[model samples]
Target: MVGGIAQDDARENRLIDLFNLHQAADRVRHGTDAILKLDNVEYEFELKSATTNKGGISTVRDLGPGHIAKWRGKHWIMAFFEGSKLLYCRYGSPDAMRPWITEKWDYIKADFEMAKYVPAHITLDTMFEIVGKKEVYTKADARKIHKNQMSAAQYETAQDTVEGYSPARMLDIFKDRARYVIERGSTLNNPHIPSKYFESWPEIRTNHAAKLRELVSTWRDAKP
Candidate 1:
């Protein structure tokens, strides 16, 4: 059920089978009496660029069938499991369905993205543990992260989550602060806000209102 593919993707290329596909077919046919035989199935293949010196890798996956759903302005695939047993799967956007693999498939010939689900147990698990061990942000670090102009990711994350202040409220606060900076374009007003907020606030050019509108709009619509 599970295998891998290597070598260039061309019809002339030969595949050295590490696992037996025919055997799996025989077992499923004889053992299940055709009940388990796949009538209509859908497969998704992915290709990804490798970061390593080697050109890249490929991956393949099979998802029997699934229904589609939409979330957050994008479509997603959804699959349901009955009490942890394997059910069926459907595909949508990343927001929707989670992917799974069958045991009989060959993975070596798969495209990079498809193969990504193949676990690199050592490296990936080590990295997972390493991430948890990293230092948590100090108060100063948190301030530093937010001090500059708000990044798109941060803005988007804030918008999607319920724990944070509402977007409208945050927008009002940012506009108020920006307006204050624009009005008091002199050194005397600089002392009021923390220096970290801006690299010594830029002098208010003639287009203060236009500039504020542009900046607010940019932050509002950005993706996380």
Candidate 2:
């Protein structure tokens, strides 16, 4: 069942079907892709597929989802793939994933300005008009505009969902969303607690392999 797949996304869907995981009813935008139940308890999970060229390294596009999930005090699964080829998945409480997430967050944040920003999505003509130029908007002018745009875009587009997922936009929205989640999830009596915790990465990986093997063999033989 996994001989050759066209795309990583297709392989993700196939993995879901193979495992009989209940897909999320709607897009958990900037969140995990689907749900998995083990022992009558459901777990939300994000599926990721990275190219095999990096010696089996997968990547996360945005730390937003992981941050939001952790702030909400939810334990989740993270599955990895190289096309149709499955890889080890992590199943842990947020407490367990926190150190890694923090490390990654720090790494990504190293390039961040942590300042105000204003985004201008205007045409070159408008830009030239603003600069009061009749003709070419030279490279020098563009450089000035770029600097202004990068610093101000965050403030202007914090809640702008329709904004494109540029790095600036993502930083703006994710920071805002993560902040809100943290405040909403906290209380005087109730503190962050992760349930359904499992820390054995090896066990999760082994189970997935065996389950997929049996599933693929049975599904292929049963195919018309």
Candidate 3:
């Protein structure tokens, strides 16, 4: 799904070199210095006080000659820091954040178990899809789906005779009825969506719609 270099090994090597140059015994002790916080583990030697001591920052020194994970033909260094209260940081473009930041930590810690299965972009896409799709449906299928989903009392009131009204017109009226119910926070049989549907709603719908759009584009491109 991704299109580009996932990781640049030469860049990673330079980062490790820089870190060793500044943090290792070679440099003079001075004021607080900032590092380029790369996609590697930093091992911090615990001192007497946690606050006083800068937390352990691991450098990719050992793996200087090893290969990292490759995704979509692009190289990415995949590492894990093992210690107490570990903090993983990545400095670069948004792509660097995808494997961990956006995907791993967006939700609750308990959600991490689910995170193993769900990627960040997927979750984000789901959210975007649902919102976009809801808007699309509101303009497109809302009235029809609303009519189909409504109940007896609602349908009775909704059936006021309109001469020469097309199905599309009827649907629009039904959707308006549903929208009114939603705005008023009224309870009705056959509500437009179930309780849980409201939680993710349009985002999931929107991503699916986008996937469809992409597929259509692909099909058109493939056409002879």
Candidate 4:
């Protein structure tokens, strides 16, 4: 019993050390050392009681990563870690993460609460279809956009040699537009997104950006 206790303590200490190292590295990478703090790290290493299946006649095992199990009449499970919090969204496979982050960040931000504006029946497959229709801009597109913006500088110089626009300034503007297009197109093409949630995309993105940044910062600062 004493040996078993010592082994468990050693494992716990190792995990803590690993988290500390991750937190330290994040601080340097994101320049969030000032605002981020490393707090106690806790994780659920086992599947929750509610997730398990046991019956008098038969016993079906709980699902692990990449494994499928039936839950609440649904066959699929989508799981991901938000900081140290392990979240499970039902009725979807693991591939749902991309669509979830791209199309449903606002919904997830509210802890999956069904509010007046939020859609209650939007399935993960629907989100995946929405994400699929949207074009993901490639590096080639970026280069083409940059080239067109730079060409405008030549036209400006010919029209007014003395007051010509700066190439760098034009490039900055074009880059911003490109980013906006990439961000906006995803949501704009999805007609099912609620107007209220769509309008709040900027706020949602900002909050998530900060949360992710802090999460990384803390993880890197961890001392494993």
Best by lDDT: 2
Q: Which stretches of candidate 1 lie over 4 Å from their true place?
A: 1-192, 200-203
- The positional error of residue 113 in candidate 2, measured at the CA in angstroms, is 6.9
lDDT of 2: 0.45
Better candidate number, 2 or 4, judged by lDDT: 2
Question: What shift in Å separates residue 114 of candidate 2 from its native position after superposition?
Answer: 2.3
Candidate 4, poorest ten consecutive residues by summed lDDT: 43-52
Candidate 1 structure lDDT: 0.26
Tens digit of per-residue lDDT, candidate 3, span 1-224: 13212233333333344233124445322211222222342222100101113332222221111111211112122211233322222222223223432222232333323333333224323433433333222322333445456565555554434332234344445445434444333211211111231222121122322432343344335647
Model 4 Cα lDDT, one tens digit per residue, 102-139: 44444333332222123334443443343222223333
Which model, 2 or 4, shows the larger TM-score?
Answer: 2
For each candidate, what is the lDDT?
0.26, 0.45, 0.29, 0.30
What TM-score fits each model?
0.14, 0.41, 0.15, 0.17
Lowest-sum lDDT 10-residue window in model 3: 43-52
The TM-score, computed over Cα atoms with residue i paired to residue i, of candidate 1 is: 0.14
Model 1: per-residue lDDT, tens digit, 88-168?
322222222122122111222243223233222224234324323222322223223345455655554544234443333
Error of 2 at 11 (Å): 1.8
Candidate 3: lDDT of 86? Answer: 20
